[model samples]
Target: MDTQSITGATAAEIADSIRTLHERGELRAGDALPPVRELATRLSVNRNTAVAAYRLLAQAGVVVARGRAGTVIAGMEAVAQEGYAAGSVLRDIGTGNPDPRRIPDASTALAGALGRPVLYGEPVIDPALEQRALEWVGADLPGRDLRITVTSGAVDAVERLLAQALLRDDAVALEDPCFLASIHTVRLGGYRAVPVPVDVEGMTVEGLRAALAAGVRAIICTPRAQNPTGATLSPGRAAELRAVLADHPYVLIVEDDHFSMLSQRPYETLIGPEHRRFALVRSVSKSLGPDMCLAVAATDPETAERLSLRLSPGTTWVSHILQRLVLAQLTDATALQAVAEAGRHYAERNAAFAGALTDRGLPATAADGLNLWLELPLEAKTVADRLMRRGWLARTGDEFVLGEQRSASRHLRLTVHDLTDEEAERLIDDLVDASR
Candidate 1:
């Protein structure tokens, strides 16, 4: 289409016009949009108007700016998800799931959860869970005023937190090779994602500074056992980040401690005592089971109040029965012991896999999470393709990545804790063969 064809008086009008063209198949994916100055001249609007229009489109994931390459329409594929890929016959090692055998039996918890019926207008949080959660989560928080809010899972809590704190086109800083759910949440919420690189000690200081300089309104950090890479925030790095964030006290900082109970590393936080907006979320999925679908969020009083508005009575409040069941398990000595054993089990299995790969010269690091982020000499896709032929399905590091970090794609995130000894040995041999 010609530059004159893309007509609008305001940013929203221009954005709507472009979206209409996309819907009618006139502006297809990868098609370049006119430059801001050219578009402004053609539309008889200010250059800033054109910029705002493009920014709106970008936030909605309609088009991407490629610097010298200019802005082009983005592909509209469904967001990638975690868990098992459908119809794959190979022995899948990239499911990102905890071993089912390690999950504590919730039968007893369920029985305990069966109590008097809860009514509307009653407090949403289960009393016991709330009390235990405060003591558990409050211990790490630097802020004195902590209020807990319950959500479906870590993803749900993140989505809600972002929605409550930011506008559609506001910028949110996310780790480059971020968690799948976080990427999807930012995109689907129509917010701009500024990529922050993650290194061995979690999010790098320089990367975070750049993101903050870019004017990000919020940040989602994985403090312990970051997804895919298994990198935890070091104490030094955490302190550096806190010092950096100290200047931006009003920006919303969310710490998703998904592997809290199951992580082998010590917890390090970015939220400072003086910071005004922040939340620390702990989900029971890793230690208890995914089915529990519960996370406890400790946030500033104002943020908690805002979250409560979204999770109001007789509406979006999480199920009391579910909360009670999780509480039952948390308090049960046997279940707690099982959770500890599961943590150890994941560490041992991942370490063994990493050692096996290292022995063969790949030099893999086990870290803390369930998966091994193994870097190889060959391209991960090439190895994964070869592994598929040998009855395996592995996830490449690119799947979790945000921006152009192709070098990081050489690594694979494999879940091998549930594999039998023979299966583990076979996988090691097959991985070596695949790398060649």
Candidate 2:
């Protein structure tokens, strides 16, 4: 087809044409577009207009610029959303959930929260809750001018933060084996995810640097108990990442400390003190319960003000009662003890399971948080199939990968903390047999 028939004079028209071609499957994923000069000549447009057209396409997640390699189609297909899989007779180890038995009862706290009337137009966050949240989150953050915002959950806070700061198709740096919610939010928002590979010490410095060079507008990182991998950021690794990010002061940095009180490791961060745009989010779900659905966001002033636009009084404020309940549970001695004990329980159980696996001649180690990231000798799907046959269900690592690289992973994220001693032993034996 002639270039004039395929495209148009303006940048917007050219972008639309490319998008249409991609939608119609004519421009497949990884297919390179004609070079900027060639396209400009063919379309009888200025070179800058062609450049603008390509920039627009990159922003919309339709294509990616590979620097020296030229631009290629992104081919970002929506993976299956992660949540509770359908009911099965098999024991499910795939759900990345905390042990229910360990969750403290909030009945008394909920009753206390209901005693006072919470009228609209009152402060969005409870006064007492705000004080506690500031003190709690501020203790870990390095910034002096921190502002707090409360949202429905970590996912909510992240979505709002990105919406306020980024335009559609802006590149976001995300850990390769990313959290399910993070993946869903980025894809649904029409942003391209620049995959930053994660290791035992969290996101690698080189991976992050490369993403930044690719012009990522924002970064979302898990500082501890990273979902699916249970990887925590080490002190050394955190320092290295911060050094690299120092050059890009305005790039938004969001640290999702989802495991907060439940983690056995210390929280490490990537946001340097002088960093212009950043946020650290701590969710109460893992420590309290998922039903709580509360997260406190600590961010720079400008980001906080922008995030507040979406969270203001009338539109979508988190319930005051929930905030009070969280505050009550946080301060209550009994509840604190219960939460501490729960943390210990998860750590001990995971450690015991890892030891058992090691004793059985399998190389395994429990890292952190509610799940164990088990690396099997075979593909995770093969192991999952054998596990299903043996009446156990587990999440494979493939579901967590973002970007175009969809190679089968050898890892499986199993929430084995809820299993009894006997049950864990049997499962480990089954896993070993399955690998063979």
Candidate 3:
């Protein structure tokens, strides 16, 4: 099959032609696609048009760009599974979930939201909710022209934001040992993930520069309580990142503050005053409950306009009831107190667990978030197997790695907040033994 002969003038037409070729099995996985210049010349189209076509194909998970090596058909990308395995008898510490006991009951909030009928063509965001969100998120952002938009959750907001700004096959900088949902979102969208190594002070400066050099068009960063690593951005680190990003003003930078209300650490950001494209997302899933399915997205005017297109009436809008419920929960004095208490509980429990592990010579620390990221002496998989034998389930660090080939990761992300003192002690003992 001669893929070089494939031709179309427009991006859609070119993308369709290439997709058809793949669907018909003429171009299988790993088959090289014509370079942008060659394809443009052959089809009598501009080079940008060919680039756009390849990007479309990439967004559709059809092909991947390999820099100087050129673009090639991509194999199916893997999506990580979240939550717990069904019917598992083992104590599942791997599930990165907030304690059910801590999630505030929304019965009263639901009752309040049911007072009015929300009809179609109404405002996408409730007026009161929008004002409250603006106040809450605006105080933390560095620039003016901040616009508030609501989405189902952080994952949904990220998907829409990326879709709005980037074409498929466009490189997106993501943190190594990233959140599972972020990893899944990037792969499913067919965007090539350029990894930026994250440290105790959040994303590394060298890593961001490297990703930028790789021509990454967007970046997804967790400002605080970064999943798996639980790394928060230090003021110094945030300033350095902002300085690096200043040169790349148009790169879409998304900050997913998923642990917003639940984090003990203060919020820091990479979006500078002059940065053109940026978004900060805060989900209430951890504080209220995952079932709330609500997140507040604050972005620049243009990104907000683009995001609103998908959220416009007659297509899809967040249910007004859910919005009201979230608003009610946030506004209610009693609920706010409960949320504060929940935050402290998570911090204390995780800190206690980490301290216990360290005292036993394990050298662990719960920096922030619902889980403790422990570095093991042995390979994670080996320790995982040993843990399974001890009837405890944990998530290995390898599942969160991107663009790196380490022989093995000696890390595990375990949620120890809900465990009792005895339970934690037993698990710690088991972990210590497993690492040996």
Candidate 4:
């Protein structure tokens, strides 16, 4: 240890030293370093100097402090995972993944529907598809005269909802670290975002109240399969939300149930019978296929009427052929079964990886959704970059944050896919190393 007073040293020097040490393998991810007192004494610096140094590392996403675990390096200088990055690079870890091998044999469904050239002005979303969508979603929804309106996908539905329910500058409450599309949807629409913090039980009631008091007029929440954190709202949490919104009857509440059909957690409806204004949206990208780009929006009658005006003139109505294909596949018992099986496969694989991690003594794997919500001893982005270097890419929590103080989290979002036991083990080992 160099006995040099860091009090007079610049922030850049401390950062440079940390980076150099990490690159030279003098420090490894998750490898705890000496305490601030020890490091400061060894470096002949004041305690504040050492604290500042560590703070620099944390800001740069180079290290983290885990109380008694002490301070540890944050991400890998090397190592990666196997999956595909749909854009930018060919990372091995897949995003928006569907079990390709598990997709319902589209051959029969496609063939049956491919023969017709439906004329323009046909049902933007085929009626058959809408009916099937209603049935699939209706099982979970009750008492509100629900009507289904299909759109290009979940994002499309969100955009349309925002267009109809809010105007520019209106405050829309969002989960603190929300889904990427949700963040983009609100921001692109020029709506202000009020972030509500989320915890294990899902969106915190206090946070929602704060946002409501702050005067947010619209809200978008994921009842299940919330992206990034994979935090699902518990029944109690839902009830809490209903209570908060009970007085704010005018707020436009939109629940994006993207993973409704495939969620591993038990279904819980956020809409209480007396809650008058709300919409429930679900997309089939993960289960049906991303290319299908179909999502259904079930809204209150007034909202439905307003949305219809937005839909009337444009081809924005979903394509008839595509809608028919979705309907055709959805109505088939075999196709539906295949989709169910695919969901099970995702749940199983994700659970396996999470279990493997827990079994290894890191037990924070219990959660829902398609990806593993992983908190590393390292910064989430650093782990992702390291994984990328090793030929894999994982989503960092930052990508989903909609707050003004947007910062990276120590959590990584990974979608587990077809991997042999050996591959899974290797992935975890690499992650452990990458975290180091």
Candidate 5:
């Protein structure tokens, strides 16, 4: 190794440099580190110095080494920086999102309690946080035998559940025009999402039956506020689905209640007691706040065991600080009220937009979620084009649906929360004129 090539820095100094690189995302998890000899030659450090630096990184949990193979960056979280290319803060009318300000401010008393060192070897899920989550879902869950698991978020829970229950090429039934994240997750994990039709009452039993007949091994259903459509699974429809799936006892059922806290509709779970395997995922992204990155995954004990395996100590775990903060906020009576009030506000605003559109002689559907899923008289693209000219951005329903027929439902998903009174009226007028 050429010792003079670099500044001949000390092993500790060399390690610190590498650590800095890791921290700044220059190196990432799963990236293979250069061989010690190669690194020493490049950095002009002694072979022993390079080895010592690598050893220090290993001890610090920043990297892991495999005998004879080599070392790789470890313990880093995956953060995908996509979609935000549109800018950090546009009017944000395109995304079906909740207000970050609506999240209850963490109490000073709770913040003061974190003065003690949060040791590295702590339990992945905090006890207090778990209890709070149980209180949140445990009360509403139809079955008494339900078990609880806290995931990083709804997406994390869905991914973990799919991993536990599905193999490559395994078929899962998902509502057509389902949650975009669900479609993407199944696709990335090499599973096929069989598109089931969603109707006015929510996921139709006939569509589910067809999906099951197509030999789907598992099902991912949204019980409340089906994404884009904002159709909540009604109790009558839920019972019908439970009966259809009753014969297919072996198939796993995963219900995503993404709008659980914000839902103005009735509570309807399709997981029957006799059904062997299932999971209930509730996310606070729409109500408490999207950035909170918190979700509760309630399931049977067996499913919980599998999910726990995915959330192992060295694997992905929700931050203790974040969990504590959410728990503190949720436990407070005033904080819960804030969440409730915010949910009502989103629903009211969304409904008002639908009413405004209807008043302007545009076809509109009143829904219970953060967005308005409108059925336009012309193609969604035509409406979107007209809206864009008026300085508005809207996501067409085509983006949310699956299959070859991406021409769309002459539908658009409008983020109604960001709509101002004048903007809302102008949009209605424009949509009416365009439809005609």
Candidate 6:
């Protein structure tokens, strides 16, 4: 098969050609595809047709974009996983995990959580859990016509929310340097992701306007303690975003407040009073435990109805036992206190690490989450290699980046909240040395 023979006029035809090439063993894994402009010129098609073709291949996991490195056939590990790497000897400051000691003990709650046996025809959501969730999410929800749906996790809720409102290739706005799961979800779902940049005050007004102008059908935002950067939405910024969104009333807005119980920042939402389509999802995965896979999705009545279609009987539904268990923990006074204390614990550790970095002249800031988003003066990979030599494993910011920002990513998202005083001090010293 001649490489020059790879040809097609339409995006779908081009994608099919590549797939056929791969199937026939002419294109192997890690094979480089032609640059978009060059491919467009060769195929006598519009440049955008070539770009869309590559995007189709990417969404189907047939290829991957590596920034300036260009696009290539992807291996199995294209999607990044969270938490510790398997069988690693280095001190891991990159695993974005909560302190095990902080996760409230569910054993006692579990014993009582198993209530009466639920039949298939029964309501999916536990009644007690529904009331508790109503009180919890209702406090912050702007619209009064809120309906709750329980899903496996925040990720599940986001997936369903997007599925309910969007079709394949529809534009959806997502934060640049977004959460790994969100990036994977959008790509795998075959939706075009419009990157909205985040500053210290959360998503930028200009970026959101651009995405709206691009006709995004949906938007996913993190109101407080946004991942990687820990960028929280200021009241002023939230108001600005709401105003921008006011004109596009029907655009589906999904807020994943993953750090709801653990964040020290105040909750500020983008959903204004007149916003018609919105979903506010909060999960116990962070505050309770990852094993406790349950999230309360407070959504507009119509979206709830549409999302409920997927959660119908016999197909899929969150276990009532799991819901009851989470409710027990949520209502327990002692467990509530533990969650609060864990929030303080994370804040203190991150702040101390930030101070250490500042004293060493790195000048990092610890805002309001379990991780510190440290911008390095040196390239992330260069500094990561140095850190590796010193027996530390760190995640670079590029892994979380989307769109054109990947090449310029020089930040590292470090989970140092679980580090002890001695380990923290040594890691800080090692980081300062690594940057040099």
Please, what is the TM-score per model?
0.93, 0.87, 0.88, 0.76, 0.78, 0.88
RMSD, model 1, all Cα superposed? 2.3
Best by TM-score: 1
Candidate 1, 180-235: lDDT as tens digits: 89999998888888999998899999999999999999999999899888999999
> Model 4 over residues 306-405: C-alpha lDDT tens digits?
8877775255777666777777787889998988887788878888888888777665564777677788786777888888787666677666666654
Worst 10 residues of 3 by lDDT: 401-410
Candidate 2 global lDDT: 0.89
Q: What C-alpha lDDT, on a 0 to 100 scale, does residue 155 get in candidate 3? A: 96
RMSD of each predicted structure: 2.3, 3.7, 3.8, 13.0, 11.6, 3.6
Off by over 4 Å in 2: 1-9, 13-78, 403-405
Decoy 1 TM-score against native: 0.93
Residue 200 displacement in candidate 3 (angstroms): 0.3
Q: Write the per-residue lDDT of candidate 2 for residues 342-379, one digit (tens) a residue.
A: 99999999999999888898888889888888888889
Compared with the true structure, all predictions reach lDDT values of 0.90, 0.89, 0.90, 0.75, 0.77, 0.91
TM-score ranking, best first: 1, 3, 6, 2, 5, 4
Residue 145 in candidate 2 has what lDDT? 87
Clash pairs of candidate 5? none
Task: Residues 1-436, candidate 6: write the lDDT tens digits.
Answer: 3357677889999999999898888988888899999999999999999999998888787888889999998665577878898899999888988988999999999999887888889898888899999999888974478899999999999999998888777899999879988998997787888999999999999999999999999999999889988999999999999999999999999999999998898999999999999999999898898998999999989999998888986568988888889999999999999999999999998998999899999999999888999999989999998999999999999988886768667999999998888898899999998998
Question: Which ranges in model 5 have alpha carbons more than 4 Å from their true place?
Answer: 1-92, 107-122
Worst 10 residues of 1 by lDDT: 1-10
